[model samples]
Target chain A: MNPSLKLAWVVLLALELSFTQVWTVNVVLIVICLALMIWRRVAIKRLLWLTGVPLFFASALVWSLTLQGSASHHFLIVIFTRMFVYVYLGGLFTQTTDPLTLTRSLEQNAHLPAKFAYGFLAAFNLMPKIKAEVASIKAAALMRGQVLHVWSPQLYFKAILTAMHWSDQLSLAMVSHGFVEGAPRTHAAVIPLRHRDWWLTGGSLVLIQVGLFIGLP
Target chain B: MKAWHLRDIILVTILAIFMGVIFFVIGPVYTILSAALAPAGLQPLANEILLGIWVMAGPLAGFIIRIPGAATLGELLGAVVEMFLGGVWGASTLISGVVQGFGSELGFILTGYKRYNWLTLVISALTTTIVTFTWSLFKEGYASYHLGFLAMLFTVRFISVFLFGGVLTKLITNLLSRAHVVKNVR
Candidate 1:
């Protein structure tokens, strides 16, 4: 099993254990996942982008705190901690888990429709390529002395144009490759739940449930 | 499609789950958790205001998907993702998600779901603001805050929505369009 897939199952178990209570534990789990990703040699820049999302929210909370009186400051702190952890966990999971494995697991275990799943899988696979295209577009624009300011409406319009182009090509490619709805296909690999995966999932669940019970009034 | 090819079924399911996890769980949960932890009274108004802004995601989704129930489904999916991942508000997050999506969808519906103009975006922002604020009144006890505080919350929320959901989402969709990822959907 891929290490990232292992991490995702662990996080999912932790989430299920919490039974929809106290987000702090989930946040901690996210941080642990991020550490593991770094250990596994993922690029620092990508990690930074993932972590940066939570930071943006944190800044909003900070701004809110300054404006309002600090009555719920303690509550806010706890929330921020959880948010940061969970976001990183999500980032790590995506970075490490292969989309192919993820798709297979969802189909076999969760009973999702193949047509929708495959379409999305294709879309996910295309994300990196789409990103590269965006970069090239920006670079080309820059060469023509176009300022790529995010705040500008022109930049926004240009981005939409680029996305539409990519989607069209991708859709056409899929159709040409016999990826039509209802087509018969064989699985490339099976996503089995190993002993390690089960143990990790169970352990995370037990720990979370115990913590929540202890914390509750 | 046809009795469901195992490979295709699995692939699509995973993709949906992944997208669900990324958009619904990661984004909103992060925002909600951060808002919940800020220093007490100091953050409530601003946090609520920010929540209003985040809620505009529904209308933005509608604009992109342009399908019936797209806004509602997208927002609800996002909320469910957040809840499953452990949001601070617990079940209450789901309630907010429904109301916010409804509010945004109303704007789209009023525009006949055809126009993606600035007016429609502004209406979407206002609709989200009003609906989300109404929910906060019940959940957060709006009676606790002064009139001035409430006004500030509304203003900040409007500005946030205009900038983030309206401006940022537009920018993202535009990029997607140029790449030909969202063709003929507008």
Candidate 2:
């Protein structure tokens, strides 16, 4: 199967699994993806970084338990399981779908304005650049004898400032490129929802509705 | 008018992912820290403060974008990212995002969507703070907390909003406005 088609199925299955709250869906997906990564000879380090999400959720659960009253064991299990599933599925979507295809699909299918869609796309593409800029800023501060720690409110403030600066530059670049509101657009690539796409989407929605009606408390 | 470009789409996707990671990591940490470290009998107050912070995101987004649905969409995007990154709140994050976004949207709407002044920001803060905290009171079972605790929480939240969400967001937007980028886009 084409990776895109498989992606559609994965998305549908994820949506269905979300409704039922059967967290095994996430576990299976993660395992399969891991297996595939190994098969494809993908880097272990990159895969490990992706697993950071689960660690994050675990920390959150521990924090929540400490701060809030002890939740039922069952509830904790459900929450953690769902978190794994949700994050992994989301990660899979990003990993599988190219940003351009995703945005093009949204614009073509949803009738979104070309400008807004592009603006949104621009924001996504800027993420790496933003990260690089933030790293440079932190390094510069460190060279000046400032320690940048996540716990420090000053660090947060600096991040906000960096984001704002980047956004300002991004908007200017967009305008210079003639990205006007309500503009007509011509795409270099066309993203059509094939028969398999419709089937996957429909199947997922149906399964979710059924699961909600039957399984939800 | 030029159409949507491949680069723009890529940017938004990356931004969403970045925001997803940040919100996912920070949101739960913030919630837990506030709930844990807040003085005993101050949970309600903490809830209020958190809600106030949550509400501020919308007005801040709106102030920066000045576009219809900017507040709601931006807040929603943030929430969605948080959820995608597997926050402790699960799907409820989406619900909170919508309500909080609406609260901020009400403030912008009340200003006839024309002004992004300090008064508008204050109103936005109040609107989001009230609605969000009210929701939190129910969601977190804050009804068990004492009245005094609730009052303290509200006060702390008011201060937090004024300082963090209100003042800080406005300052950032102002800087952006002066950067010639906002002027050019407008």
Query: Each model: TM-score of chain B?
Result: 0.75, 0.77
lDDT of 1 at A176: 83
Worst 10 residues of 2 chain B by lDDT: B1-10
Across A1-217, the per-residue lDDT of candidate 2 in tens digits comes to 2334544555555445544444344455557656755665655665665577556544454344435444555445555565565455555544555546756777776677776667676776665665665577669789999976433344444555555556667777877878766667788887776787668667755765664466443
Binned by DockQ into CAPRI classes (incorrect, acceptable, medium, high), candidate 2 is: incorrect
Where is the poorest 10-residue window by lDDT in model 2 chain A?
A149-158
Report the lDDT tens digits of candidate 1 across residue range B1-186.
123233322322222233343343235544565556554545454464456434644765676666656676557645644544433333345455677788788778888877776667778777777877776554443433557777877787778766756766666666656656554343
Runs with alpha carbons beyond 4 Å of true place in candidate 2:
A1-80, A132-184, A215-217, B1-57, B76-100, B130-162, B173-186
- lDDT by candidate, in order shown: 0.57, 0.58
Candidate with top TM-score is: 2
Over B69-158, each residue of candidate 2 has an lDDT whose tens digit, in order, gives 667766776665554343434335666677778878878888877777888888887877787667645444334345665666667777
Residue A98 shift from truth in candidate 2, angstroms: 2.5
Interface quality of candidate 2 as DockQ:
0.16
Model 2 residue A76 lDDT score: 50
